[model samples]
Every structure is written in C-alpha cells, then in structure tokens.
Target: MSLVVPAAALGLVAGAGTRWLLVRLPRGAPVPVGWCEAGLAACWAAVALAVQAGRLDPRWAALLAALSWLAVAGSATDLLVRRLPNALTVPALGLVLVALVPAGSGAVQRGLAGAVLLGGAYLVVHLVSPHAMGGGDVKLAAPVGAAAAGAGWALLPVVAVGAAVASAAVALVAVVAGRAGWGSRLPHGPVLLGVALAVVAVAVPGPRIPG
Candidate 1:
C-alpha cells in the first residue's frame, strides 16, 4: 500500500515518455495517444508492483523499469511499422549487459550465454523463414534473454515456452475473431517481452519480507 502512489506516479511518467517516443518514430503512423498512455501506465504499474512484492534490490528494480519502458516503446513501433528499430534494440541490449555488472559474476555469465542462445535461436528461425520472423525480433531477443538469464538459466526455457504459447493463443483469437488471417504478420515483440518480464518477476530472488 505504501508503494502504490509512487508506483502510479512512475507509471504516469513512463506512459508519457512512451507516447512521446511513439509520436517521434520515423515513418510510423501516429499511435493512439490514449492507447499508448493506458498501456504503458498499466505495464509500468505492474512492474512496480512486482518490484515491491519481490522486494527487489534498487539496481534490479531500475533495470526492470528500464526494460519495461523499452519493451513498451519497441512494441509500439513493431505494431505500427512492423519493425523494431536498431536504434532501440541495440541500445537496450547494451544497457542490459551493463546493468548486469552489479548483479554478480554468475549473473553476467548466464546473461551472456542466454543472449547468445536466444538470439541465435531467433536468427536460425529468421534464416529458415524470414517472413515468419523479422530481424527486429531477432535483435530484441538478446536483451530479453539476458534479463531472463540474469534471473536464472532455467528461466530461459520458461520464457521461450511462455512466449510461444502466448503468441499462439493470441494468433488463434485473432483468426477466430476475423481480426487477422492465417497469413497475417503478427508483431511478436510484445509477446516475447511480456513473457520475459513475467519470468523475471517470478524467478529473480527478492529480499525476504518479515512477517
């Protein structure tokens, strides 16, 4: 309860920033301001609650917040343009790597390995069926993988499976509702980011709360 107001305030700020970024994206359609604000606020608020509940360290919380914001921005771009800019994904990967420095040697090792594994997997998929998976998604996978790995090596598989299931579910709904056809290109960045965030929230150890 004590954390709610601050969390909400942060959400407002994050939402505004996300909206501003979306508005400035090159060759991108103007995203609905209301949608951006509402989505980002809700996403950030959930992140805040997770941080509070998990009793995460300040550094880890900050990393999570930053990743959430980037994910929001990336998702918006992908949805509008069907592209995730290198401008966003490259810097995010670097930031995630740098942020993990304080987490410990083990975390750094796992993060690097996770990045390689996940990014490579995506790259392979892109090579096999470029139309099915975009380069943007391939780039975006690295930071998500790093974050998941920072949480735990085992969580990497969980993130992968969760993203696959969620994407399939959403695709099925879209087809059933006539919102999309079987050949439609779905923006997968959001799904990947969503599952990564969930895995991080669950797998990352937090400070124990005293009863």
Candidate 2:
C-alpha cells in the first residue's frame, strides 16, 4: 500500500528512460514521451496495488515489472514499424529468465515451460504463414510468456485468449469501418503484451465485501 505511489513515480522515470532508449534504437523512434510515461506509471501502480492486495507474491514483483516495461517497449516498436526488433526481443528472453532466478526452481521450470509453449506456438504459426505472424512476435512471446507463467500459470491461457479475442474484435471494427479489409494484418505484439501485462498484474480476484 505505502509503496504504490513510489512505484508509480519510479515508473515515470523508467518510462522516460524507455522513450530515450527507443529513440536511440535504429528502428525505434518518435514515441510520445508523455504517453509512454503515463502508461508505464499506470502499469506500475497496478502491480503495486496487486501486490498490496496479496493477489501477487512479492517474490515475483521484479519479474512482472520487467515484463511490464518490455510490454511498453514491444508495443511501441510494433506500433511504430510493424516489426519487433531482435535487438529488443532477443535480449529480453535472457533478461526475463534471469529475473526469475530469485523465484526458485518451480518458477524457473514453469517459466521455461511457458516460454516454450507460447514461443513455439508463435513459431509454428510463423512457419505455416509468414505473413500472418512475424519472427519478432515469436521472440517477444518467449519472455512475455515466461514472466506471465512465472507469476501465475493461469495467466498463460488468459493472455492467449484475451489477446486473440481483442485482436479479432479490433480487426472486425476496422473492417466494419472500412479502414481495413478482412485480409488486413494488425500488429499482434501490442495486443498480446498489453493483455499479458494486465492479466499478470491485476487479474486476481479482489477482496470480497460483506455480502
């Protein structure tokens, strides 16, 4: 509870750093700094709140926070260039794995399993239809899936279904509005990361009031 505000403030600083980092990247550029900061702050605050509410274990906080930041980076990159750079996604796979060290053996195993599950699935899709899914998305999934599963195994299914449904809904809306045809491809990284972060950070059941 007491840590939530500080967490958000830290997020602002980190978000600004993220913006700078993005601008420096070869393919990353032109993200609005304010929006980035606000988004990261909200994500930080949500994770803090979840921790205070006991929905998230303190042991897993670092991993989840890292994943949140990665989500921001991946989303911005995907939205800007419609590509996920190996510079970001590949390194993230190792970083998140390292972040899971303190969580012990069970978490390490679960996280690895999650990575294989999600990343492999994306890879299969990419192999089947390169136009449908990109290699960057597949790489991004490994770390995101690792962190989500390390935090909560249930989040794996939640993120998959949520991202799929949300992407489908957005595509439908775009088609209906004549902005895109049924064949139009939307960037899947943002949708997947956003849902994964939300589910990992705040999807646990809230405290029940007197009924």
Candidate 3:
C-alpha cells in the first residue's frame, strides 16, 4: 500500500508524458486523459507491487516500466495510425537488450534468443499474411519477447499463446459485432504488450528456467 502513492504519482507523470508524445508525433491521436492516467497508474502500480512481492528486482522493475511506457506509446500510436513507428519499437528493443546486459550473461543470451525467435516468427507471419499482421507488430514483438525471455524461457511461449488467444477472441467478438470482417487488420501491439506484462508478472517469481 505504501508503494501505491508514489507509484500513482510516477504513473501520472508517465501517462502525461506518453500522451504528450502521442499528440506531437505524426498521425498521433489524443487519448482521454482519464484513460491514460488510469492505465499508466495501474501499470506502474503493478510493477511496484511485483517488486514488493519479491517477484522482480529493481533492475527488472525498471526494465518493465520502460517497456510498459513504450507499450503505452506504441499502443496509442498503432490505434491511431495503424502503424507502430520505428521510433518507438526500435528504441524499445535496443533498450531492453542493453538493459539486460547487467542481468548476467545467461539473461543477455536468453533475451537475444527471445528477440530473434519471436521477431523471426512474426516476420514469417507478416510475410505469409501481410494483410493480417502489420510490420509494426513484427517489430514490437522482439522487445515483448525479450522481456518474456528475461522473465523465463517458458514465458515466451506462454506470452505468445496468451496474446494469440486473446487477440483471436477479440477479433472474433469484433466480427460478431460487425465492427470488423474476417480479413480486417487489428491493432496487435496492445495485445502483445498486455500479454508480455502479465506473463512477466506471473513468471518473474518462479525459478529462472534456462533458455
């Protein structure tokens, strides 16, 4: 509970900064302040609680926070422009790889492998069904995968499966509601980000599995 206050404060700042950047970027659209505040506050508080619960160390918490920030920005951008700019995804991927350096040689190796595997998988999907998956989503997958790998190797498949299932469910609902058709493009960044965070939160407390 003590962590909540500071976490909320930091969340407010992070949310506002994210929204500010979103507005300034090309094809950027404004999101409701309340929604942004609540979403970011929740994400920040989740990290704080994970640290308090000993599920994650300060370094991992910092990395998650950074990735969450990028996810927030990427999600909003993707929603508006149907594109995830390299500006966000590329820097996020670089940051995750660099941040994992001090986590240990094993972690670095796992993170890199996770990035390659997930990124490559997405690339293949994109190549096969360019209309179904966006290039931006392909880029976003690397960092999300790296974060999952940093959490645990087993988490990579878990996150991937979870995201796929969730995205499919959402798409199915959209089709049922007539909001989208079978071939419609959905914004995938948000789903990937959400799954990554959830998987990290759950897996970080477990014994580290070798990648």
Candidate with maximal lDDT: 2
Clashing pairs in 1: none
What RMSD does each model have against the real structure?
Answer: 3.4, 4.0, 2.6
The residue-by-residue lDDT of candidate 3 on 1-211, one tens digit each, is: 5786799789988788777776676766667675566677878888888677666666566667766776677776777667787767887887887766656677778888999999999999999999878898999999988887876788899988999999999899999999999988789888888888777765555324332
Comparing 1 with 2 on lDDT, the higher-scoring candidate is 2
lDDT of 3 at 151: 61
Please state the error at residue 173 of candidate 3 in Å: 1.3
lDDT of 2 by residue, 79-114 (tens): 887878888788887888787776777777878899
For model 3, what is the alpha-carbon lDDT of residue 135? 90
What is the Cα-based TM-score of model 1? 0.83
**lDDT value, residue 51 of candidate 2:** 76
* Pairs clashing within candidate 3: none
Q: Between prediction 1 and prediction 3, which has the larger lDDT?
A: 3
**Stretches of model 3 off by over 4 angstroms after superposition:** 53-55, 206-211
- Once superposed on the true structure, which residue ranges of model 1 sit more than 4 Å away at CA? 1-4, 45-54, 208-211
- The CA lDDT at 168 in model 2 is 93
For model 1, state the Cα shift of residue 27 in Å.
3.3
